[model samples]
Target chain A: MAKVPSELRYSKEHEWVKLEGATAVMGITDYAQAELGDVVYLNLPPKGTALVQSHKMGEIESVKAVSDLFAPVSGVVAEVNQAAIDSPELVNKDPFGGGWLVKATGIEPGELANLLTAAAYESFLEGLATSGH
Target chain B: MFLTPLNPLHRAAGARMVRFAGWEMPLQYTGILDEHRSVRRGAGIFDVSHMGRLEITGPQALDLLQSLCPTDVAALEDGQGQYTVLCHLTGGILDDCVVYRQGEGRFLLVCNASNRPKLISWIAGWQRRFPGACLIDRTEALGMLAVQGPAAPGLVAEALGTGLLALPRFHLGQGLFQGDPVLAARTGYTGEDGFEVMPAAAQAPALWRALTERGAAPCGLGARDTLRLEAALLLYGNDIDESRDPFSAGLGRLVNLDKGAFLGREPLARTKARGPAERLVGLRMVGREVARHAYPILESGHRVGAVTSGSYAPWLECNIALGYVEARLAEAGTVLQVDVRGRLAEAVVVPRPFYRRSAASGEAAPREPRAASAGA
Candidate 1:
């Protein structure tokens, strides 16, 4: 089963966001990384760049295909994960930990309520698995 | 959906299954990078049963093949194979295939899976011209497996209980695996010292088990792609198709005009003198980022051509690709730029086979001590 921690919120695009005070740490879910297979390159948006909710922040190229990374909430990109950029395979190695893509500060606090909870995201992945996508 | 005889074996090895050319095949077992490195540094086995197999028999088989293929089929002695392309009347490639002469008036044509139906119809048309010949689609009857890498020969020799050192490249012969007939040939799409084994479908599971037990790591289509790309081998649908001529795909050597009248000979002869506008060349990226297929190859600001295949060559530790550039830009030392995701990645034209092993020189490197013994 894919790990979905209760403290983290999920996006429909399979990104997980952990809220720490006013800042939100973002990383792809376990289910997302499994589907992507061997993340080769991660194109991250520049720090201090303002991103709107549901807007593409960057791109991730795996061996199979390239996928656009969408922002779950509107906020300023305070910091980008330089570690993940240097070793993109870290996303495949540890998607929930050091492989986090970005840290966004000054995000709307109300956006967290709209994101899916751990149980909801798990069920969503279940549907995808059965449908053979 | 089509499935290889070793589908269950792949599942047992934890391979990720994916649909490819109508076949439910493994896309990767452990991972593409790991499998690719195993094939380069050690050994790897692939279930390639999805490749179409057609057998031609009868007194006029050789004559029919000679008429159908662009290469000189009659010159291929028994137990020998040659890479050739079947073409249409207008010099368009029908399918690129490996023709193996098993016996007098008997040959096997191994073709790409997607071209099976089209090639079958074309062969049927040729068979009608030669009334005495017979063509049989034996794709369902045979299970194909490719064992590749530097250590492949030793493992294969140990498995078959025979020394294949005497057998030259592109030659096929009959062997036995646990008393079952096996067609073992020293040929593969990956640029490595390897053999493709065709065994009866019933025995495929056992053969796969034995090979895996003998330390041949299971690989899949994902690794197969990277390996072929590193070798600069052409993938049919991506690199060349019916619309592309042999010269444009850098396959001019496979076409022989002196052999006389055959399908596409006239147009090929005409194109040979005039030269193709676009030519295939190897591109080495100046940076770490990979330039994927359909990425534009530009000289200054002008788009010269497009990338046909590209990947981060794990063996070479750099990004390499194959692309068709303008005839002037196809030179070995020409510097170019590949538009990779809106960013221009610098590239330099290089000779084919970005990774070449010295095993072809017949001077074998001293074998490393077996890993199992070292740990024990």
Candidate 2:
């Protein structure tokens, strides 16, 4: 089973988001890393760049395949994880902790409604797992 | 829907299964890099039962095979195997296969999984020319497992309770393990010193378990690709295919012109006289990042060739690849750029088999290891 933190919101693409006032912390979900398999390279968005919700922010290349990281909420990019860039395998080791991709500030309040809660995302993953990837 | 004899074993070991060539084979057990390194430094066993096998027997078998393959099959002694390509009349490669001459009038032809149907049709079409030959498809009756690495010989010897170290490369022998027949051949796709074991289908799972218990690490198709790439061995579909000629793929040594008339002899002779326009070359990156398949090779901002197989070599510690380039640029030490993703990455042409081993000394030679990683 994949880890789903109750405090965070998730996108269908498997990115997790944590809101702190107007800023939101973002990273890949545990399920995403398990599916990607041994991340080798990470192309993260530059700090201070603005991103739109549901748009591709960057890409993460794993041993099996390369996946595009989608933005779950719209905001200006506040910080990008430099550590993840140095060691991409950390993403596979801990997708929710040190493997966080980016942080964004100045998000619209209505964007939270578009993201899925922990229970809903867990059910969504169950459907994907049973449906056979 | 597809499964190997070791499917349960793979699941127990936490392997990630993926569909490859109609088989649900493990893509990775621990991880691609870890599994790859285990094969390089120690030992690894691969469940290659998915590869198709055919047995051609009878007095006319040698003559039939000699007429089909481009290699000199008549020169092969009993218990020896030779890698050859079956080509069309136009000189295009039909399939690359290994022929094992088990005895007089007996032979085993191993082919790629995807091309089994096409090869069967091609061979059947030519059967009328040789009236008294028997071609039997033994893919379902046999299961193959490859034990590869520096420690392969010891592990295999322990498993079969026989001294296989005396067997020279490309030689085959029959042995008994637990009262079952096992065909052990010193043939492997990985550049390492290894052996491929062929056993009856009913005995596959037990043999696999025994080998695992005897210290042979379980590996999947993912590591198999990286290991073969490091050794400069060509993968049929990815490296060489129907559209490519043997001469253009740097497989000129396998073609024998003096052996007389065979399939695709006319075009091969002509192509030999007039050198191929493009030839296969090895590429070494200037940095850590990798250049994947289909990446364009450029010389002075112009497309010179395209990459067919590219990966980060685990043993070499660098990013390397095999690709087709204009004959002029195929020379070693030629500086070029590979368009990786959207940016041009600096690369240089190098000799094939990026990893070299001294056969006489049984030690790896000194070379600067490249710093890149391969994809599964």
- Here, model 1's chain A TM-score works out at 0.97
After superposition, the stretches of candidate 2 with alpha carbons farther than 4 Å from their true spots are B358-376
**Model 2 chain A lDDT-worst window of ten:** A59-68
- What C-alpha RMSD separates each model from the true structure? 4.7, 5.7
User: Which structure among the candidates has the greatest lDDT?
Assistant: 1
Give the CAPRI rating of model 1.
Answer: medium
Candidate fnat values, all: 0.29, 0.29
Q: DockQ winner among the candidates?
A: 1
Q: Per model, how many backbone clashes are there? A: 0, 4
